[model samples]
Target: MRSVIDIVDLTAAEIDGLIATAEDIIANPAKYSEKCRGKKLATLFFEPSTRTRLSFEAAMYELGGNVLGFASADSSSATKGETVPDTVRVVGCYADIIAMRHPKEGAPLAASMYSPVPIINAGDGGHSHPTQTLADLLTIKREKGRLSDLTVGFCGDLKFGRTVHSLVKALLRYEGIKLVFISPDELRVPDYIRDELESAGADWLETASLEQAMPELDILYMTRVQKERFFNEADYIRLKDSYILTADKMALGKSDMCVLHPLPRVNEIPMEIDEDSRACYFKQVKNGKYMRMALILKLLEVE
Candidate 1:
């Protein structure tokens, strides 16, 4: 079975194929309405989620498939101390495919090992979020009209932003893709990620000021500082407001520069900027559903 635990699980070519399928799905929704009519998708979200969980269920429903499973661990056997693999093994028997989101890193990988059906990692702690990366890729492709030869700025919680990690890995495969890491020192991109960039010989730079990097970025990807990911409340308070993207800051960016964010945004992005033509976060959310639909069809081998 083909399972995607990390963005690396799908090659650059596979990503391109998925993007193409997503575009086709967007253009011709009716043609794929019944592609998975009899199949079922089980969403085992052990953590709290709004977009990812709903996106998966919505994708299945749009494809004329049914969806089952819990939105939280408190509602599942996991609340009674049931293990991930065991839960996945049982769910796999009933569902044709599984999309799992867990609080513990590598939990999806462990579940994938025991699952009979294909496993799609919805999100796992701060490790990786491949499907979100797919959404990011598609959004970049659609908004910018191409994914290559563009400078992307990743702002806020780089340390705990799994979306950032996954997207960075995916973008490295493309040429002329420069990465600008905009974050406070405490929440800087992880060393392991830096190691990967260096190993790949990719062009990347880190800065504390978003304004300084804003002008050069073709895409500004903002992320909220995750209070859930922090162990110290004081630290969270100090860095939570680190990079708020205001209208003044938006002026520093290119007129055609697109802004993207994984939703459930906090004060980092104010309501005023939503009117800006550059704000594509809402577009990113809609594209997320399309990308998940494409991924579901691809993993299930449905025509």
Candidate 2:
């Protein structure tokens, strides 16, 4: 009867359960392989996000379930006059569960109203990406050995980074967590987020420089500076390479500090940086699959 619309929808205990399940899948992968056999995951992507779409499909496939759906809205009847609720109602008949990514802010929320099957919001506009938040939590737990009491620095285009926003909200659910925000003046963390942090009493600070925050971070989550989110391509071009992470940047941090990204990079992080042992983004991506496997088992088994 519940849908994962945002990170806030998950209680602290439930989030802990998910993280524990993710780690369990990592340790015992074979046990989770046939958990969702005969089920079907329908991916309804209104936008062109190959990574997110593929991740969802792969998650279902790895769970011994089949995947069926469209990669973009154009290829589906959505391009015509079909409403989100209507589409969900129709797709729910054929799909055991639905994962939808839309460009509209409340599209997934709208669909969940009539969906017979459980609905998951993949990335509704710049609003939320809860599963990616799951990946972030798992990465921090695996890399740092704990989530609470560790400082996390979120660098790059924070103003429009949905992953950062969702992760911040989820992190607030834990105790003794602190955040350091790094972004250019124009792309700084928005006031609404600052208000939420203050209201929740989550300790945080903002800075334009990454080096100042780097040394203190237990985990550094880097996000891409999206050009489409900017008013002008020129401003994005100007700031795109400003926060580039290389060996020298890693040299400024603690040796155990882990680096993460919700990827598809555009020079924000250099290729040479991947050679560093602490560069955990690749492993983070793999962890994403295990996390998804755990989640598929959890959500489906809950009822």
Candidate 3:
């Protein structure tokens, strides 16, 4: 079975195909209302979630599929020391597919090895969030009219932003894409990610100033500094407010430039900026459901 444990699990062609499918769904919603009429989706979330979990359940419902599973580890058999493989094995029998989020990195990958049905990594600690990247790709395609030949600025918490990492990996496959990393020195993009970008001959640059990079970017991707990912509370306090995107700061960006955020924004983005035409984050949230619906249909091999 085909599973999406990482964004790379799906090829550039497959990603493009999924984007096309999602676009079609957006245009013709009623036609796909019963695409997955008899399928079941199991959402096994070991960590706290609002957007990801709800989006998965909503996507399945939109496709006429049923959803079952837990919202947290304490409510699941994992509280009784149930292993990922065992939990996946059991869920695989009852559901046609599984979307799992865990606190440990690579947990979904481990579960995918033993699952009979397809496994989608909802989020795995600081590791990967492939589905979020899909939503991002679709949003970019819809907003910018194309994905390639664009300057994308990623601001805040680059070190722990799985969505940023996954999106960067997916963007590497496209041509004429330039990545600008904007973060505090302590939260800069990981060296491994830099190494991969360097190895692939991708165009990218690092900056501490979001304003300096703003005008050059076609897409401003904002990310919150995750307090949950920090070991030192003092460090989190020092860096948490390092990059807040305000209207004055956003004025430096191009008029046509789009701003994207994987949501549940704490204070990284001011609420006033939500009124700006450039703010595409809410649209990104809606695109998530479409992309996920397209993913469910593709994974289940439904026509």
lDDT tens digits, residue span 79-143, model 2: 79899999999999998889899988778889989899888889987777888888888888888
User: In lDDT terms, which candidate is top?
Assistant: 3
In order, the Cα lDDT scores of the candidates are 0.94, 0.86, 0.95
Give the CA lDDT, 0 to 100, for residue 30 in model 3. Answer: 91
Candidate 1 local lDDT, 133-235, one digit each (tens) = 9999999999899989999999999999999999999999999999999999998998999999999999999999998999999999999999999999999
Error of 1 at 134 (Å): 0.6
Worst 10 residues of 3 by lDDT: 187-196
Off by over 4 Å in 1: none
Per-residue error for 257 in candidate 2, Å, reads 0.6
Where model 2 places Cα greater than 4 Å from the true spot, the runs are none
By descending lDDT, how would the candidates be arranged? 3, 1, 2
What is the Cα root-mean-square deviation between model 3 and the actual structure?
0.7
